[model samples]
Target: MVVLAKAELEQIALPAAQPPMADVRAVDLSAAPGPDRAAAARTLVAACEEQGFFRVTGHGVPQELVRAVEAAAAGFFALPQAEKEGATGEPVGYGCKQIGDGGDLGWIEYLLLCLTSAGTVPAASFPFSTLPCAAVCTERELLEEYAAAVRRVACGLLELMAEGLGIEPADTISRLVADAESDNMLRVNHYPPAPRPEQQAGRLLTGFGEHTDPQIISVLRSNGTTGLEIAGRDGAWASVPPDADSFFINVGDALQVLTNGRFRSVKHRVVVSSERSRVSMIFLGGPPPGARLAPLPQLLGDGGGRSRYREFTWMEYKSCSHRGRLVDDRLRPFEN
Candidate 1:
């Protein structure tokens, strides 16, 4: 892996302004090309290639469900800090910066849960935990419903991605992510207003540091607060504003590996904005821990059939992220 110095790391962390937020492209999943799914697949290929991020509309998820989940999450976060921190579980439950070395990263709290057929796994089984607030139990039904809805959309997107790559919709990337056994999870993030909103070295203090996601794909719904940004091809950062009616799909490290870099794993971060508190939910679809991932031969483009990355399971890459720095390239260790 390439070792970056502090100055280089700081350079990578800087943010830049993008074109007007209204200019971002949106995809209609319900669009029909000759009464088939191929049209949406082709439309997404170009969009996905563009910085690995795009907005999705016509996703068929009910607005009432979205509101219900958001209300439930907000209620959970509204609890007293101590009450919110009372119940602990592995890799799931509530997390605040209070216990980690990331105190200076800015004000943020999150609830992480692993998805399963039976519903969300109990927080106790996660690798990390703080506590499950009373609201978690109260909101469990809503959370489960929300997860099912989002997971359906994610699976549809993966099918389109597979079709875009000229493979069977059910045989390619979808196969890795579309089952109950997949190690998919959802994270509900709340980024509160930071104490210092001033710029630091040309960047605002971040709620979450800049890094590419580790899953195959991530579907995000942000409340109407603007702070999400992605690193552009020019090495500058561009903010993706909150789109209430759309899901922002981000290609992750696993997809980058699967496509041999034809698509990208965008480096993104959440910066603290104005006094308005913000909420965003992310449903990350990934392969089961034991699944081996590598570039597909179909996507290698016949240049002697070489893959850009080596075969590695999601668990191997996840372990690297947990043990090493999150800002570092988690995929670098997997390159042959």
Candidate 2:
């Protein structure tokens, strides 16, 4: 790993504006492919290649829906410490699960599920406490609604990604996912106030440490707090701003391994913020189940084969996530 100087990190922490909220919506997927497609694809590629991150607005998820989920999450965190502990899971830095179920909280007190299986919290790989605010129907409804919207947006994005890669979108999608049950997740994470950044920079890190995502890409939605950081190609770190209405997308680790690094899985992390609370939902792109994961055939092109990582089940990779060993790390768990 390349250790960066504090100044370099600070430089990376600089932020750029998200695309206008009205322009790129969550529901824009409904729009037909117009001449805007070229400009949009070019812009998307620029961001991906240079920053590994960018925001999308008009994403179609109503703003009220986003607020409702945030509000419900806040209400849950507002509960008494004991109540919170009752629902909080796995320890911090390792991804929170339910408490006594015993892991500590990651920089978040959160819940993890999927758009496809909304409201039904199954046993996920990186364990933690179950969702504490099960009673919050508003949160569940709004969340699932947003998740569904995102699912549509993700499909559109994948198609766009396929176009960007010069192949038919369905062709790429068919090869990456398992069957019809490809993996997609929704994590509602809460990061409470924390120790000063100056202090943390010297010792322990925040909710998560720096690591690349392990999925193809992730669509993220966050509240107005800035603890997220991304690594620049120049070895700098940049702050990922909260672009209202838009979702942040970045490639994941598994994709990089499968692509033999042709597609980068940039490093990103969540940091401590003393100013206010933080919340965000990140969705990962993956295929159904045991599709022999490998480099997209498109990448192989009419060219030679380039093998980097061996094929494995998304389930197998996800399950071994908590094995406590790093040398043979393969599965791409939610948290870094």
Candidate 3:
């Protein structure tokens, strides 16, 4: 709902203390690489090949802005129940109300905003990023400013991804230039302290549940919290910690599919602490509501560039996802 000029900010860059494995090293590498684009590109390729995620340094988003947003989200969620509930309920048909379920929760609040003025409301206005925030925090321009600034970083990333694929990075990213479905979202997720065990069930039954991103990719900035869990290659879950002044990158289903499994969309969840609160700013770049999603030309393995799957919009995929059943079940259909 707002936009800010890129000129009003200061950024600091830090080196990757060590080489990362298909991972974001909690540094800044957004619109421009910290040291060298070619070096950053190699790091990015290595990350997606193995880790499927990475932390970027030198993206120009201020750690202060990240702190401010997290603080605002915490303060907003800490408001009285009535105030918090005012922004809770959401339309069901669009699967928005699911965010409000699991009641008697901690003081975490959420706010989402749809950047593009595409196909009118009533049909598809319930974007996941624009969850409502407290009125006090609503008036601040930093949220929107941060979004626009990060968008540039996203564009740069997309193009870099293209280059990593051995194509003209600009050519692979052409669809994003004027495409309505090349969407981006910003969210402020707050986690308030939990009561004693007698009063709360703790993280397993509270806070945000386990979920994988539905976008092409997600970039996150979070305060030092240990609740995040990553499923390692052994099918075991490992707790992922936060590094100071860095962004976390994770691939989404769309990117995974488009890249013909070259990229992976991993499942992650937040575990709320019984004592300290947590807040994080998340940005997801996904295809538009109805943008057709399928494997990309270069990522396809065989048939001289044949795609492996049919194209489906995110809404379609989500509709099937809401059924809570795997779309491709083992029950074989009769061949005619």
Candidate 4:
């Protein structure tokens, strides 16, 4: 864990600039199944087509569970650097500073965990087991509960997306995520506060670099400290207001391909704050490694018009994405 000092942050901080607040669409998922649910689905589809991002409320995840998991993650992140490093593992565990093996760096620290189809965290990758028995038990339980709750929310949202697209079975897209072999992951990120406002010149520290998710979808919730920004279609960045109670969704590269270019894969990043830490938990929903990814025939016109992206397996796309920088256009090679 290489923590950056104030001087190091200053050297990398970009000039401060205020971006316009994005008018992100919000949908209420608790609507009863009928006209209300239909309306909500319509809204979701519009949001996906326009920005590939939206905020969701009434997601059914208990606020208490959300808070508990956040607290546990915070406690772990607050641990001494050496103590936290004990839980480190390959691809899944505690990581700081370095974003990926490609040498991308960020002003962030994170815990990455994988969830099985059974909704259980693999004990082999458990980061809390090294702690006291009681602490480990509590943390593990909280993480499992949180993962289950969020998984439900993610699947439900996918079902609604399918509905809005007027697709058959309404699970055409969602089944990929609910599959027994689905590759799902949860990441908890902590961006520490920067130096005092007066100590540094006007600048913003990059917490996470701009990038599009390689999975099918991503659901994120963060402590109410603003820093998130998403790039618009025009290629300008806009800030997203923090809403702790609602989960923000991001359409990923897989989904963009699946929809035959109807949906977009949003690019986003986080900037560090000077007064408060930002803690975010993101659930990345992915298909199995062997799952074939291509444009849905239903989305293509009756004659099955040309597919914008070439067919590829999830593993191939994931491998391609891993070899690039954070801001690289990962889907270029797959484009037709």
Candidate 5:
């Protein structure tokens, strides 16, 4: 990854402007099963339809665990560039600035890890295994624990969505994410503060470019500093207020297709803060490579209504998404 100097950083800046706060819905995941749970499910469905985004409270993830993982991430990113680079691996390790081979750049550094079916990082290929911090078992433990907890929250949300949609089996959607060969992933992003010159100019740098997740869903948690924004119904950007205690859920492209357009896959991006750094942890829940993807029949009208998207395997869609730019309409090629 190429490190940008002050001049290069300034060149990438955009005019700073505050966006209106999004009127995002919040769902209480701890709601008990009967009428309460049903009501929560309805709200979740409405949120998905309205913004393809929502906040989750009573998610059951321990605050201490979240903090521990954040601290560990801070420690890892604080290492010298060379040391941090040592953990780099193909598509699943330390990355700086450049988002992908497609030439997209951001004012961000990140750690990407693939999770196993059991929700644990593979020991042999652990990205941090060679770092000095590897000896600190607590760091690794924190990652595993955090992944497991977040996965539960993600799957639970999927089930709630299925219930609200009146799908027969509540697990119909969650099952893919829980599959033995699921391609789940965890990403930790660190967006450092902008350069002083850029700050003085009141310019905002793109921490992450706008794009929709290719998986079924994404669960994200970030520190108090705000930078995240999602596209509103009018195609204008709306700022998402930071709530470290709550989890934000995003409907992914796969989910949008599965629901036959009833749900939307939102476009979101991040801008860098001049004085504060932003750190976010995201859990991307995907299905197995071989799993078939198509609009669920239940969502279609009687007599097997026409499908909006052509049938494709998860691997095929994943490949297509990877080959395109961040803002490309990935679903266009598969559209009927």
Candidate 6:
């Protein structure tokens, strides 16, 4: 847990090429619009194998929609405390750190919404009838649009990953993880300004403790505020500065399970800034609630025909993740 000033951040020297904790590859989706997907696939695969994280640009998401979502988030968080509290619920709604599960509160507030309905899937099929954004209608509209846009990008990335793995993209991993009935959650995190900007040991504290996401993939967009950090291959932490031009794509525990440990699920944390509030939107993709997950047969090799992990349902995994402490690999319990 360290905070570096702008001068200090600039002073830290990194390797000329392939820096230890700072190398997150960026891929342009629009580079080859005609299905000749050589360049993007190579970069995407390499990034996933190296760190399970990358930046994506030319993703075709409208800038106006992004801005509208950001503005709506800001407005929603600015509402009265009671108003925010009205949106609080179990897995889907507003949550303040002080009232978090087991009292291990992070110094942040969030609104979680379930987005399970798609084409042909009735809107009533989801867990919640309406989003927590009833406080602001525009927020709901913008968030729904943003979620669809992000989902498209996620699916496209999954297709590239499938091609990289030399597998059937539409019938295997991508299909399973992004199925119409899959459990998809959107998290809107609001890290309020820290009360003490002068504190040395506990500067801003941590918005969220270090942990790997339990879903298949996470697509995140930040509002130009630095708070996220990812652990590198050497167990050292590197800051991920906010880049408006791209979304930070992170592989999650479910993906690692599907890849049989070839692709990693990076460990990351959010560190708050004492001087400014920060907002980030994250879209989570995972298997259907009742779907049983394990290392794909195609991914398993000739180790006496053994799999790295035992089969487990998405519901069971989600329960394990929420019940246990948020640290280290949450998938270890199911490892064979």
Residue pairs in collision within model 1 = 87-131, 87-132, 88-131, 90-126, 90-127, 90-128, 91-126, 91-127, 91-128
lDDT tens per residue, model 1, 194-279: 44333244454457777788898899998878888787878677777777899998899999888888888888887764577788
lDDT of 5 by residue, 192-256 (tens): 87766634376788888989999999999998889999998788999999997899999999999
Candidate 2 versus the native: TM-score?
0.72
Residue 299 C-alpha lDDT in model 4 = 88
Q: Per-residue lDDT of 51-101 in model 6, one digit per residue for the tens?
A: 889999889999888888888888878877776776666556777764235
What TM-score do all the candidates reach, one by one? 0.85, 0.72, 0.73, 0.96, 0.95, 0.85
Candidate 2 Cα errors over 4 Å, as ranges: 1-32, 88-106, 114-136, 169-171, 174-179, 196-205, 257-260, 302-304, 324-336
lDDT of 2 by residue, 1-336 (tens): 112345434433422233222122122334457766755666665555555666775666788877877887677667665555554333321234222121322345665654342222333322324344455444556666777666666666666656666766444652453234667667767777654566345433345555666567687888878778776666556666666667777767666655445566777777655457787877666666565566656676423565555666666665564343222234434322
Task: Please give the clash total of every predicted structure, in order.
Answer: 9, 46, 19, 0, 0, 0
Q: What RMSD does model 2 have?
A: 7.7
Question: Lowest-lDDT window of 10 residues in candidate 3?
Answer: 7-16
- The C-alpha lDDT values of all candidates are 0.73, 0.57, 0.55, 0.88, 0.88, 0.75
Better of 2 and 4 by TM-score: 4
CA deviation > 4 Å runs, candidate 4: 5-11, 196-200, 302-304
The reply for model 3, stretches above 4 Å from the true place, is 1-35, 88-109, 117-140, 169-178, 198-206, 302-306, 325-336
Q: Which should have the higher TM-score, number 1 or number 4?
A: 4
TM-score of 5: 0.95
Q: What residue runs in model 6 are displaced by over 4 Å at the alpha carbon?
A: 1-21, 33-36, 98-102, 117-136, 169-171, 198-204, 302-305
